[model samples]
Target: MASNHHRLSGAPVAAAVDSAAVRITGLTRSFGNRQVLDDINLTIARGEFTALLGRSGSGKSTLLRAVAGLDHGTVGSGEILVPERVSLVFQDSRLLPWLKILDNVVLGLPGKDARGRGRAALDEVSLAKRESAWPHELSGGEQQRAALARSLVSEPELLLADEPFGSLDALTRIRMHRLLRRLYETHRPAVLLVTHDVDEAVILADRVLVLDDGDFVQDLRIDLPAERDPGDPGFQHYRTTLLGALGVLPAHRTKEQS
Candidate 1:
């Protein structure tokens, strides 16, 4: 993991957008008659930051793969269509060892202007200076940023993120949150983020959906303002509400802090 796109660490996203970027109807998946995802009906709107919340085995990641066309269905029914493009940013950076940081970002792109696009993506994350650097040389944050650069350089129409910041420390995670929010506003892609962090979902998503036992348990539109701060009372209220939606036992708290 350390040798590859993981430099230490890391969308055309849009401002004004239209309808749902990816729509799923009766989306179900099974493993030898054991259902993993059961009747998932959801719509992810364009230019919207949406989050999928669930426990480890709730099939959140599996749903993401299905959307990405990375996995085939066994007994489900659904379609993922994109006029532009679709891409996924996994939990790990997944960089190539032989490729330089910039080259890795340009992996999917043409070699000509790949570096340029790579640089721009890095600039968005404030890691442009590390352009020529090796993946193994960067800090965890930088590596993640580089990985993001690679993902965004493709200018995807639909962006799927699977707990991209799950491994970061509190401070780093918050920083990544702010970075993502800014990039989302700038690049403006339709985002479907799958995260275990309730606070993260509240902070980053325009709408939050909870998956329980392979099906959606709660789907809520966040009425909180975009400029919401974790320290603010209104934000806290909304965060608490999201926690409740996640079926928090009132005893064990969501690991994600505001």
Candidate 2:
């Protein structure tokens, strides 16, 4: 909700929360002597959608893994407060070869009624009909939907997504984005998505943070309405700024997008 300038644009949108959702203070990570993250401080609000935007090797994914407890000792000098039950959606499906789509989702569920919940998740992603099919039998989009369902089945408080839709084609990716928004709207989980696409972040995230070499280079809020058009002036301005923040230039603009 604030920029790097130590100035408040307006009052924080989220308040009166018992938990910080996911808080990281002075988080740093290194392999050998090569530092990946350096003094990263981030606070993800409860039930908020935040996108981590950066080019390859920006350490955004590393930060997500550290919070998920997957990075082990790679994280350095940081305190990550997250729920015990965490779920992550990777770029690949990682589905079981023998299990069906529904079964894959139910993997994280408790023994009592995992099947029912899995079926519901598939229905949520419009993949209910494919529940009985094997992972190999599903299309690429369907496979990604199954992966999403698997991650959300446990209903974790913090969702770590690393390019969940990167493998899909353009149309499929757009549909997946719409589906993701609907799911996030319903579940209201604190989400941190690591993506290389600035446009995707602009369209889906409440706020976008651009990272460079494991440090936050630009912190910005999408200020445009939720139901904003990509061609709208405000939306375009924010997108232009974000792309510029990532060091990407507009197609026709002469000077760099500043």
Candidate 3:
């Protein structure tokens, strides 16, 4: 990891004074004549959990790419200052087929302690025994758990997830949610999750933001306690509000209206 630190030396300095893990101002991205993202400005504070909700082709992924610094040549203009240490998890595990689970976690990690740290991270996610297993051998949820270990092994200051649980079954997604919350409590990394699931956002995030036509349309704060009950009137209100922002109406709300 000592050598890895040198590679991260060039990353933009995070604005710790303002408690911002990520800060973007007047950001824009275009593909030829088509503007995919337009003049977007947002800030994510340290240790804050925020979720982004948007329709398909609404520039949610584009914005996430910009913040991850993966939009280097594609970005037309603007400043995206992200924390020096950032880790991203995608809907797919994206684990290498050839590498063992342990190796996958320590992929970019350097220094002598990398393996130890990798094992510890797997243990954190309750996958210590599967360290030697192949990616194809594990179940989908287990594969995602390994991916989580890989992301957290780096102990990043900011974590960016792009619909990570979208591919899982409902029950598996629920389990992942609990695991994520536990990990957040332990590590406290600033998190920005890009998701289309209104219920998931309401259940997990401290703040939920809606993006429509390349711009932020709504910003809502979830003030409920750690143990949230979807049946709670407050949860229903948030769910209804967010669904409405996404141009959706929950089944219950529709039934009530009828």
Candidate 4:
């Protein structure tokens, strides 16, 4: 596969007015004869939080990797426009066991105040006191928190997360959800979170997208209040709509009803 991805910049004045944090046009990715993405076009506004949901092999991670410029084998005719500063968080924390928590956060970070910024990032994730601890010393959730700090230490303009909380238990996932929301608000970075959990998407995203068969099938804006509760009627409404788009009936809804 040959890469067709390029950096986007130098837009005209009118286009600059509507500039996006991440813009992908006519993007497609294929492995062998199977296409993962099919001429998909997407634009995420500055500081907008967008969640992507899809079943396995639906190309969620492929799209994210394309934007992050990590898809070396990507072959398609498309243009991806993203800020120079981009950070990615995966399902695993990916921390170096040999490095201390603070060092892990600041790894590869440049500048004289890198250490100070690393400390501040750790503080934001509530891991300030664990700066000297090793990755193995922290719990599963704490390690993920450190990973988040590492992503934010550079103050990226766009943050891409691929199931960053998938490994945690139910309670830890909820806590991480709240923490991610707070960080998003404080940092105001354009975020694209790839998740399988519909509830998580509805809780954290300003807009939700459903991808199926290598194309985006639904684009729904989340209009719920910031303080969302799963039991709220509005929350349930969005959740149901998204679930329906993914071709899954709600647990309470039966095939006979449909």
lDDT of 3 by residue, 1-258 (tens): 011111112245334335677777788888888887788888888899999999998888888887887765563777766766789999999999999999999998988999999999999999999999999999999999999999998889899999999999999999999899899889999999999898899888999999987788788888899777889998998888888777786445522210
My TM-score estimates for the predictions, one after another, are 0.85, 0.87, 0.89, 0.90
RMSD (CA, Å), candidate 2 to true, equals 7.0
lDDT values of the candidates?
0.75, 0.78, 0.84, 0.86
- Worst lDDT 10-window in candidate 4: 8-17
User: Which residue segments of model 1 deviate by more than 4 Å?
Assistant: 1-18, 73-75, 250-258
- Please provide, for model 2 over 45-90, each residue's C-alpha lDDT reduced to its tens digit, 9 standing for 90 to 100: 8887899998888888888877776665343666666655467888
Clash pairs, candidate 2, are none
Model 1 alpha-carbon miss at residue 235, Å: 2.0
- Clash-forming residue pairs, model 4: none
lDDT of 2 at 21: 75
Cα lDDT of candidate 3 equals 0.84
Of 2 and 3, the candidate ahead on TM-score is 3
After best superposition, candidate 1 residue 241: deviation in angstroms? 2.4
Which regions of candidate 2 fall more than 4 Å away from where they truly are? 1-19, 250-258
Rank order by TM-score, top first?
A: 4, 3, 2, 1
What would you estimate as the lDDT of candidate 1? 0.75
